[model samples]
Target: MVYRLLKYVVLGPLLRLLWPTKVTGTENIPAEGGAIIASNHLAVADSFFMPVYVPRRVTFPAKQEYFTTPGLKGRLQKWFFTASGQFPIDRSGASAAQAALDTGVRLLAEGRLLGIYPEGTRSPDGRLYKGKTGVARIALEAQVPVIPVAMIGTDRVNPIGSKMWWPRRLEIRFGEPLDFSRYAGLAGDRFVERSIADEIMYALMELSGQEYVDVYAAKAKEELGEAVPLHGRAGEVGAARAGTAPSRVPESRAG
Candidate 1:
């Protein structure tokens, strides 16, 4: 309906002419069936380019505020996001994260392509950040494949806090599906979840060529605050390997 209209008749065509993305590895996407496209969140543009290029419609768990805000502008936003296939999930309270995971699992059960940002939010400084384990939980619980996606050079088109987008050559790369069937029944195990999350992040690092930071993007934003610019700053730490989460990260899935 609206999703098709926007992707084909309206927004999609405009994006193609304006940005002209160099997307590759789309063949990696499964021809049919439920899967998770776990991506590195570089900018808001990452959200647009990732789904528009993929063949299937993508459903994402947008923040509740995007739907619940007041005024006419908010109403249009709610309509647009809903029409574009986004659903609202409360990102507050203790169970907030779980709610999102549950929603993702439900979508997967319905055989929809669920797009998730393992880092939870956009990269505050263009470097990959520590990923939350929710993506692992969703993949294992739903028993589906997780494909790692990387959006490159998007920051140049629309940097954080910038009100405008400019035409820039951007690349979107997709890696082969990451199978976690080896740890099938261990979904709730904290170590297994963290291990899986780290593995996905590792794939993004390789595909995106961005440095990896041990800190979460939200925390990094708070810690650095106004002192650091939102884009172009180097990662505070070098690449963190699949099994090498920082001290705060739980132990690996190994016995």
Candidate 2:
């Protein structure tokens, strides 16, 4: 397929040459069969860097807008996303999130690897945020092991508020897959769901060594001045108060 050709035969070789990435624990990923890669999202480049390093074809859902632009650039962007094996999902609310989770389950059911950032969005300050329960739900539903990935030094490669990529060292550490099979039947129970989610976030925290925020990624984004767009999604702001949202560390602690 186009994705394999682009990655192994074309772009992968070029990116490896240009960035010279160091990928540790490649063996942590199963050589074949299905799996889910739950990574800490730090930078825009996280999307691009992780897939090239994993031998299996890893498909993740990207925002729908990325494929909806206009003109030549739009066409090129669509092509790239298609080649990268990303499908579009509206990042609006529980419905879209559930739909995305369903998509992930379908992929796993068919024996494909699916990548997800349980934080839901990029970490603004590189600290691991509380993971949403969707990740636990998927693992339970699909009966797949979750691979905890720690991405270091990607933020420097393409920092926020910047459009260019700078030459930087990239380190990708893949921790052993975390299994929650013991809680097999409780995946749908809210209490068990939350416990499993917390477990995954803690694993990511231990691997990344970034300050842990007990809040969701989008809320942290708002606090960091990257508020949701005026005409964009509705739940990003007010929904913070809807659920028993996780607590956040003081800014000083995060710094």
Candidate 3:
């Protein structure tokens, strides 16, 4: 299969040789069965390095644009994404978030490992940001555990707005799987969902040892610009002044 060929023969070996990644707490990953790997997105390479380091095949929902380009390069991009276990996600319309949640639920129901960046977008300044509740909704709906993964030093490999990649030693630490069965049927409760998302983000913060920002990463990028302040409190106040609140689960029904 193309997946195996790419992982074992081509990309995998190349990544290992270039980055020489060090992974710890991998035993936290289930040998088999469905689970969610919730990670703090640091750089574009986070996605690439994650699948390369994780033993099991991990799939993440990618924007449809990654598959819809109109040339030979686009075709190669589509092939690479597919072989790497990524699937196209149409993130448009009012139900875009729900659509992604539905896809994640389906993947988990089929016993596949789903990779999610709870922050929804990469941190503009390498700090942990508030997580969206969609991750909690999918985990509860699929009745699976959420594993916290932290990718360290990936930002140096591929920083924001940079097309070139630099070889750097990357560290991936997998935390113990978080079980939220206590809120099993309460996915509809906004408070409970926020709590679940907060819990996951907290775990990521501890694992990654990055400063935690209460506002969403995209908002921080937009309002605070790429040079996010080093002080967490200042950034939070600026985001608050900019009218950015913590992310919540979409009210739309998970299809």
Candidate 4:
């Protein structure tokens, strides 16, 4: 498949060479079952790196704009993501969220890995933001485990304002899976969902060692008046405006 071949041939070799990575708790990833890998978004490189290191093909819901471009560039962008096992999610409207969740649930039902960033977007600072309830809803509804993953040092390689790369060492740590079966019957309750989301964020906080903030990505994006574009130049601009640059993120070895 494209995911395997690309990882082994292109991205994997480059990652191993340019910025040697150290991974922990990779075994925490379920070998053969549906699970949600919830991670904190720190940088643009976060998206590419997470998929590269995971053993199974983990699909993330990307904005539909990545798929619907105006020309050949858009076509290739769409192809790349589709081939990489990522599906498009319209990050707009109430209907879009429902549709996105439906796609994720279906993938889980088929025993596939569904990777999501509950914060919804990369944190301007390296702090773990309050997660949206969508991730919790997905887990509880699908009866799946949510694996907390914390990524460090990606912001250095391709931080907010850079077109080029830097040779920063990257580390990805996968935390133990959190089972939500205990809250299955309470899936539809917003209060319960938000509580579960908070719990997941706490796990990420412990894993990544970043300060926690009680704000969702969408709200943060709005408060900053940032207009996110599809990809390429527009994406770079948005990233820069949003302060996605590398920072002295505080992290320590897990005890």
Candidate 5:
């Protein structure tokens, strides 16, 4: 298949020779069966490094625009994404969230490793943002464990607004699987979903050692502009601009 050819014959060798990625906790990944790899969204390269390092073929639901761009370069982009095992998803309208959940659930039910960015979008300032509850819903629905992953230094390699990649040493850390079986059959409860999502984000924070932001990454990007203040200070400023009272976010409800 194209995925194997690209990984073993082309992209794999080039990425390893150029970026020099270091990965830990490969044993934590399930050798078989279904699971979700929930990770923080730091940069576009997060997607690239995650799949390359994992032994299993990981599939991510990329935005449809990545596949629908016009011209020759667009076609190549589409081909590369497809070869890399990414599929397109329509991330528009009110049903967009549900659509993504459905896609992930279907993949999990088919016994594949699904990579999901719980933040919904890339972090504007490299700080880990609050996760959306869709990841929790998928895990609960599929009855699979959520494995937290952290991509370190990917933002520096392929920074936002930069078309060129600066090859640098990067890392992929896989944390132990998190089981939410205690909350089984409770996916419909919004409070339970939020708690589960927040728990996954907390694990990502510990693994990545990034400052946690309680607001969603997209909302922070809109209110705080493209450049969010680094560290944990952006939350207060963003909350003020968005007219929400800033409070200490609990670990179990950070999302």
Candidate 6:
């Protein structure tokens, strides 16, 4: 009820009117089923705009801090996230990634739509990054189809570190569902899992029309952050690899 109220009566109308979003290929979404919607993480708005356009409720794994913080401000934030279709997940501890993967699989097993960013974080420079294999693991474990969705121009609407949204054109494109039933029992095989993740990223690249970066976005951002203070601002660096590239070889072309 809260999610519906916010999506239709509250934030949905306001966001659509302000951003002027255009969604395409929504028919690719299954009417009802356990599925994973793998999207290219461009901005925080990607989460907001996606659920507003889709017919079904989308649940994302948000860091626990978003719901557990103290004070009135924290309570408001918690309410908004829950209303916007997000659930808290603890991201601490050595097994955090695996724990999150298990949570996603559980949601899928229960016949819910799960939204995940394969890149694990927002693109540092709007280029698609190499995807983490957790998405593949979840799909295999839950035996669900993975749908690739692309969010275009959301960066302008909600840029990194920006306090206010700048009205801009937005688009969400959905691609055909990817079937990994062939790899059903091979969930824990690292090589097979990486292959699945690479395929998913390749699909995202075609749908999103963005250049594929073979490096992880978080590492790329860390390198950018470290170099920006000394040489120039982040924009000037523009996804500086800073020697993080070429360390690991990719098994497949993510593009």
On TM-score, the leading prediction is 1
Alpha-carbon runs more than 4 Å astray in model 6: 226-255
Model 3: per-residue Cα lDDT over 1-255, one tens digit each? 898898889988998999988899999999899999999998879888888777899999888999999899999999889988999888777588788888999999988999999988888777778888889899889989999999999988987767899988899999999888767788777887787898888888888988777877777778656655433334443444332333333335222
| Candidate 4 local distance difference test against the native | 0.78
Supply candidate 3's per-residue lDDT for 117. 94
Q: Please, what is the TM-score per model? A: 0.91, 0.86, 0.89, 0.86, 0.89, 0.89
Give the per-residue lDDT of model 5 (tens digit) for 13-50.
Answer: 88889999889998899999899999888889888778
Which candidate would rank higher by lDDT, 2 or 6?
A: 6
Better of 2 and 5 by TM-score: 5
Of 1 and 4, the candidate ranking higher by lDDT: 1
Flag clash pairs in model 3.
Answer: none
Residue 247 lDDT in model 3?
Answer: 39
Give the clash total for candidate 2.
0
Q: Candidate 2 — which pairs collide?
A: none
lDDT of model 1, residue 62:
88
lDDT for 24 in candidate 4 is 96
Each model's lDDT: 0.84, 0.80, 0.83, 0.78, 0.84, 0.83
* Backbone clash total, candidate 6: 0
- Higher lDDT: candidate 4 or 6? 6
> Which is the winner by lDDT between candidate 3 and candidate 5?
5
All models, RMSD in angstroms: 3.3, 7.2, 4.9, 7.5, 4.1, 4.1
Worst 10 residues of 6 by lDDT: 242-251
- Which ranges of candidate 5 are over 4 A from the true structure? 227-255
Per-residue lDDT of model 2, residues 66-85, tens digit only: 89989999989988997899
